[model samples]
Target: MIASPSTALVTWVLLTTPAVEQPALGTCSMGIQHLEVPPVPREKLALVCISPGQTTVINFDADLAMDSMTLDGAERFTKVEFGASTVKLIPSEKLRPGDHLRLTVRFKDTAAPSSVTLLLGVHVAQAVPFVSVLRETRTVESYQQELKTKNEELQKCIEENTRLQVESTGPGGLAELFMLGLLSDDGISSKLLHKNFVEAPTNALSATGLVSYRAANRAALMLMLANKAGMAPWTAESATLTREGKNGMGLRVLTVWQPRPIENSAEDSILVVEVKAPDDLQGSYTLKLWEAGGARTVTLHGVTFPAP
Candidate 1:
């Protein structure tokens, strides 16, 4: 026969040996959701999460065992306790901009072959003024270097100008000046030559102009003029002069000149110079002119005139 519920429970309890109460096996999972170390100025960081139970014991990995953990006021700790569901880290010193914290956390009874690692990077919220100042200093230095280079170039140009001015005032200066002036863009001197001398339209006789010589030392003046006019490329053929008559303190002379052939023309050109010189002069007072490359006049004085 079936007994009542209370009677059956009592009988079952009496017949079976008394079973002891056992504690439930608990579990925990720990991780970090965000790895940023907050800029709270010496505040503790809740960087680790422990779910469902209080951690009875905590340990660090072998590599981080000695001095890896630090507290806000305490230097280092191997084991720390948290009665709550989360673990908080305290720093021994206030965190500055760009500071980094690295550590490993091994949870008790966690099903894993290795522990979790934590890397906390800290950055200041405000702008750093020193960075701007450094950039401006570099820019100023670059500008100063550029200015120094420009000053050096300007000094070189000034020196060159001075040297040319000195050369223009020397011995054959007048003759050189006259030749350069003929080539000048104003065309005043060329027009004057065209007006005074008989025009010969030939490739060799490109252009002609006249100059006056006062002494018998015509060779020196001719060499100086050649050097000043940069006429090293042309060859001088001959120079011939005919005496006209006495004029003032010197004899009137006419010079017939020829030079080597120039480019763009098959034949060479002839030049003429009319000058007056003292009768006692030993050397011939003849001036020769020719057009070389780029229509520049090449001159040689005291050269022998070629046969007609």
Candidate 2:
């Protein structure tokens, strides 16, 4: 009864050769691993890969993610595009000579969940032609700024000239001149009148020609004197005439005056008139007169004279 037990046994066999490991999938080699394109004129570069069938994903450095690259603070590229095993780098704009570009590339194996990352560097060189272009651009900009400044100055000058013209030709301009002792009815007497009416006449007057003076009358007298002196279209400086109170003699007028000569040429000229007023008729007056050396004859209209 004790010897009735049964047992089962298993046998094993040994092999002499070892098993070989399978190769990894999605292995890639770069066709255009590095880049060295002229940055100037050309803004784009194409990066190609030898393994076209494999899926490719491109990643850019954080610093290089900008719309454009910069060299010495100048923008170089505006955009970037990635394709299957190919990447296109669009430049921001034309590059200059001596500009530098630095970029980092990381190649990942998308097919495998666990893959090693391959790092690559891309560099683009600057060209001589683009340097010249940059220099020319700078020069042109500088010239443009200069021209603008000069144009502004010229415009200011033109405006000033126009203002002076208006003041000299406006209303009461001739009367003011007359009160300053710059006008008279007599030709010879008008020539001798001083700018200051206070100065006593060296010679005795035969008669007082100016009875009641008005701005219109002064203008007419100026035209007439110009005609009589054989000088057509006479002109005068603008002046401000103010009534200083009447004395024992007549109405007193005050103005600071300077004598100018009338010329026969078409060029604008100031006619110097010398005349005498009463002793008390002199003081500072508000008047502005411009020397019309090269200006045209100013038309007389819409002038307002001060109340006497």
Candidate 3:
């Protein structure tokens, strides 16, 4: 069923389960539907993508509510054209690119995965990333300073005798933990559980965007460092394109994203920096990188590594 809550057109179908999945974490891919941007009834649904012309069959479970749902990224969808399960998209014509939609109710949800089936015509390309004007504004420059402060505090307050674990998330679904005082000063090379949760539009051409790239770099560095060739995954890595500071303390992201390779001609695509914590040190460890120069470090807090 379809309903318009935001005054923005919405379309919906009923389901009985709420199992969100992603591959790396053993979950399914997140699409316009998975994110609940389509404003469907909150229930369990197993959606199959049928592009152009394809038939789909859905089984409903129990009665579900269609009033409150999450569809924050709908603007990223140009055409959420429905397909034919037992029913097809109303308009025989394909929904065009940049087409705005208002979903009004259309499906009735029973508490269980019902025999009700639906087909949607989904499209790729020309969809803008969903960004609300009300979204928090951030200046890239100030981010590093914030990280530096957090890094210092993180290095303190938590040790083996008092080790505190802090978990955080970032763009592209980035996640990792900050462990204070867990390594020998000589063994300082930050390694831990880490993974980057990312969603690229089928319409997306590059995996390199401003925020995602920054988050990716952070994830990559944390993963690489923690792996130290092989330790554990760095689960909570993050970055800012415009962080503050001057040396390693003030790391920032470059504006130029990685583009497709052309010839071997010299092409300086801006610059990126990586921070490395000092080994065997007991102070607050921060790895900072600068585009114009090399990465630097700072001693702010203390730590307590385990015995050999």
Candidate 4:
């Protein structure tokens, strides 16, 4: 004998409707020809709020079974809680409000008629407000771009300043400090000026004078030095001398002072002197010399390289 058709309505209470249906089927088959369900109004809306540092709770109408309601936008469902007829969807913390989702309801009851199913559509109402992370990422990227631009500008400024400084101080500004008296003593013009034989001319030859020659200009003198031809050079700085006049030739002597020593030895000494307007004058002038206890003079002759 066929049993009477049983219809049970679940109560609307509690969070998610845990049980899928009432009156366990116990492996029974039924072809539900038709299913007529009343419209679940929007006024009967459900909401789930997930606040920071708290678990999310979703409450829905109890008319639907635990598996009846579907979450369309959820990536992964955590744990589903079910009550009498209501169902709750617990999703990852990534859920937020205003996101669209669709719900489909289905079932089978063979005792009704032929195979039939029931379906309903519900719009998403209120949802949890996830911390807006995309906005924060955009802000960070903008700040990084601005910082990069500032660093580039600073580097450019430094490079330009360095270039200007290098140009202003050229190779000619190194040394400018002396004069040299090149006196080929008698027939010993072939004499090699060794440190041992030649002293750092402190006392000019007083009894016998000597001829003197100076570098082209102060800039050029910075590169010339005394004892330069010797194996070891003399590193003296400021130097000058003048002697008695003889036969329209003014005697020229040599005087020298020391400069601050340099480890490189190249910056040690210099000869900065220039003849004013007399480049063509090759007349003999006595070199006014001052020895330890004597004195003398000689001629400083030169062929002019045509006045500049």
Q: Which candidate should be chosen as best, given lDDT against the real structure?
A: 1
lDDT of 2: 0.26
**Model 2 residue 259 distance off true place after TM-score fit, in angstroms:** 5.5
Which wins on lDDT, candidate 1 or candidate 2? 1
> Can you tell me which runs of candidate 4 are displaced by over 4 Å?
1-63, 96-98, 103-308
Worst 10 contiguous positions by lDDT, candidate 3:
7-16
What TM-score does model 1 achieve against the real structure? Answer: 0.17
After best superposition, candidate 4 residue 116: deviation in angstroms? Answer: 18
Query: What local lDDT does model 3 show for residue 229?
Result: 24
lDDT of 4 by residue, 1-308 (tens): 11121111001100011211112212111111111223432333222233111223322222333355455554544654544433345554343322334433332222212211211111111123211111112355445655675677578557545533543453321121111111112100111111112222332211111112222320001112222222333232222222223313221111222233222333323222222213333332222211111121111222122112
For candidate 2, write residues 203-296 as lDDT tens digits: 1111111111222122111211121234344334332122332311212122212233444433332221111133233332221122232122
lDDT of each: 0.29, 0.26, 0.23, 0.26
Tens digits of per-residue lDDT for model 3, 1-308: 11112101100000011111111201212112212222333354323333221222222222224442222233443333332211122221243322333332223443222222222223221111111110123335345545665666456424211311122121111112113222233322222112222321221111121111111112112111101222221221122221223321222221211122222222212111232223222222222221111111111111121112
Worst 10 residues of 2 by lDDT: 8-17
Query: In model 3, where do residues sit more than 4 Å from their true spots?
Result: 1-99, 107-265, 270-308
lDDT for model 1, on a 0 to 1 scale?
A: 0.29
